[model samples]
Target: MTQYIGRFAPSPSGPLHFGSLMAALGSYFQAKSQQGQWLVRVEDLDPPREQLGAADSILRTLENYQLHWDGNVVYQSHRHDLYQTQIEQWLSSGEAYYCQCTRKQIKAMGGFYNGHCKPLNHQDPAGCAVRLHIDQPVTEFTDLKHGQITLPQALAEEDFIIKRRDGLYAYNLAVVLDDIDQGVTEVVRGADLIEPTGRQMSLYHQLKQPTVSYLHLPLALDENGNKLSKQNHAPAIDELDTQATLLRAMDCLGFAIEPSLKDGTIEEIIQWGVQHWSISQLPESTEITPRFSNGSV
Candidate 1:
């Protein structure tokens, strides 16, 4: 069997914290153990949230942690032309339509676009966006960790927007395009993304693209039980203790790591970890906030 190809795509909204390490290490080891090529891509498509010095700092942090990736880094911001081409293609094929619905209107309509603009013959004026037409999404798929998951009837039937009304390509569109372009055979990331995977899979069917395997690892949450995100003010990982941090992340993934190796080198420890990497040991599918093992140590 051919080896898998996986990627860790982090947005430069803020520097990586321990939560980020969990996803990176999880995906990294999965790819490495399978003799697959692991790649890194900067999801800088969302410009407003992007930090000025964060991208370079992020690369530096990855280097410090020895989470090196293969090949040239794919920057989403630099690929706007490709996105525009696809968006225009979808529009021309009548697969997408123009929408001018404001957030306030959607809020008043009980959330989600009520297809208010779906029948509009109006052209996309400046600042307007396009939305993909969706039929009742009754599609079912299997997830690697969470087992046979089923989406709600209402959620499956919602006509999702592919391009945002803000003149920016929506996440669903970009993620599908990027993954398709990169030939991604496997998607290993945090479980917070599990909900979106079904929608992306739908788009794959629409575009006639191959679907990739998904493994959504347990999310790293904060004291508030919210996922540790840069937006939630999760402090960046302490680069000075990258190896220790990686070890702690491993523990969060449900490994009974030995104490003697807690302070070992990142590579040395990761090699040992790959030998013991057992996906079956992961906790039940639920939100989990990561806690550095002061107790485990």
Candidate 2:
């Protein structure tokens, strides 16, 4: 049987919160339940949004919860050369091209990039972003939890940027390449990223790599039904109360643990969680308001 390899990648924009913990624990349990390898990747691609010590803080927080990864942590910031090589290959082969269109221009056109610069064939690549020519867009894929997902034709056909004008690699390009490079067989992340799945799957086909199985866990929301995120000022999980945090995360993921385990150690809670983890139990909706005892993470 082929070994299952899953990953929990988080951006270092802030420390791990209850929402982030749900993704982490869900992925970890999913990987461990099958006796597969679980990996961690710090997506520190956008330096401007990354906090100075958030990366290390995330790692320490993971350790505190005993959600240890199988191998060395992969940092996207250190993999620019790899992304650059792929970008060059695509550009030389005409699979991708330079685009000078700004965000404002795209927004004016009903928010879909119309591939205006594809035929430009401009010699000057300076100050331009690299966009993949979506000759054959991916319109559908099956999610492990949500089943078949169909993407809009316009969204799939848009010539999405693979590299930004600021010279930073795009998330879609980097994530697809990284997953392929790491031999990842499954992707377990938040439903907030479900919209980009088709684009990433398209990139997988472009790279001639098989797309991996995906399971987008329901997003955790606050009382106002807003998704918990660093941008939304979600409180960071307290590593000091690792057990409580893990239990709370497990509950949010739809795992039923005994009340007796509330005071249990991290190991005890995790063991129960992994043994009982079931994607079937996850809520069908894309977002869920998580109930926390302390009112916050």
Candidate 3:
């Protein structure tokens, strides 16, 4: 029998926040309930957004909360060679092409990109990016949480870049490759990334790799409707009140709260939660953002 496998891949932009814990808990319970392996991965490919020691802080916080992970953690920052190999393989196979078209060129044509560089023998300088060719629709899949979702045509079928113009790999390319590398059987992440579901599915097809299950959890937003993130200055998770924080996160994910267990330890609360965990128990619609009026940064 195939064991269920899931991952919580956090970017090292800042210390793990309340919203981050919700995602980690959802993935953890989903994996643990099925006796599956749950892994932690750091998506630190984008250096500009990464914070110093942020990954270590996140891992320490998770451990303190008793959200233990299986095996060793994987960091995308160390996987550049794998990404390059795949890029080369696709290029040799005519599945990818070098693109020289500017963003303005794409907009002038339409909001969508036409395969302008797919058949070109043009000189693309150091800043050139490699793009994938897609002449057919990438199609749709039913989301475990949000039901049937058909992606935007431009995104699903457009000639999207695999490598960045700055010689870096794009997030879409890196994530698909990393998921494949880690043998991640399922993904549980924020609803904000639901749009990329179809694109990721398309990559699976291109590589002839098996598709993985996905669950996009609702994003935590501020009062202004902005997603709680480093940019929005969302507060870091408080280690002092870990159980309280975890319970609050579970509530945000629609898990039933036990008033009697209010002052319990993290392990005790997690034990109760894992035993009662059920995907059917989670809310299908987007949930309200969990916020503290006292404020934090």
Candidate 4:
């Protein structure tokens, strides 16, 4: 039987919040339940958005919550050469082309790029981005948690960018490449990213690699119904009370953990969780507001 491999990839844009913690816990529980390897990858590709020391802080929080990873942590910032190599190969094979279209121009075309620059075949690297030529689009895919998901035709067929004009690789390109490099068999993440699954699957097909399984857990929403995310200034998880926060995260993933386990050590609680975790128990809805006995998360 093929070994199951899962990963928790967090970007260093900000500290870990309840939403981020849910993703990490979901991925961790799913992997450990199957006796699979759980790897950690720090996505620090965008220099301008990353916070200094955020990566170390995230790892520390994971450890404090007893979500220990299996191997040496991988950083996207260190894998630029690999992304570039793939882009070069695609460019040579006519699978990708240079694009100079700006966001405003794309918006003018009713929000999705119509591949206006592909025929231009602009060879100059300066002031241009590289886009994947989407001759065969992946319109739909099945999720381990959500079942079959269908994507809009415009979104599925749009020729997306691989490398930005600023020389940074796009998230879809970097994430898919990194997952392939780590031999990740399943990707467990937040439901907010469900839209990108089709695009990532398309990239996998273009690379001649089999698509990995996806399990997008329900998103944690704030009181205002906004997603609890770094961009929304969501407070970081309280590392001081790791037990309570860990329980809240597990609850968000639909685990009815016993109250007695809360008195146990963090490791013990995690062990109990691994034995009890089941993907079928997870909420089918996309968003969920975490419940707390006290007025705090």
Clashing pairs in 4: none
lDDT of 1 by residue, 183-251 (tens): 889999988787787788878877888788888898887766777888888888887766777777888
Candidate rank order under lDDT: 4, 2, 3, 1
Q: Decide which is better by TM-score, 2 or 3.
A: 2
Q: What TM-score number comes out for model 2? A: 0.98
lDDT of 2 at 213: 95
Runs of candidate 4 exceeding 4 Å displacement: none
How much lDDT does each candidate structure score? 0.80, 0.91, 0.83, 0.92
* Candidate 2 clashes between residue pairs 3 or more apart in a chain or in different chains: none
Better of 1 and 4 by TM-score: 4
Model 3 misplaced stretches (Cα beyond 4 Å): 123-125, 291-297
In angstroms, give how far residue 132 of model 4 lies from its true place.
0.4
TM-score of 3: 0.94
lDDT of 3 by residue, 246-273 (tens): 7778887887798977888889988888
What is the Cα root-mean-square deviation between model 4 and the actual structure? 0.9
Cα shift from native, residue 3, model 2 (Å): 0.7
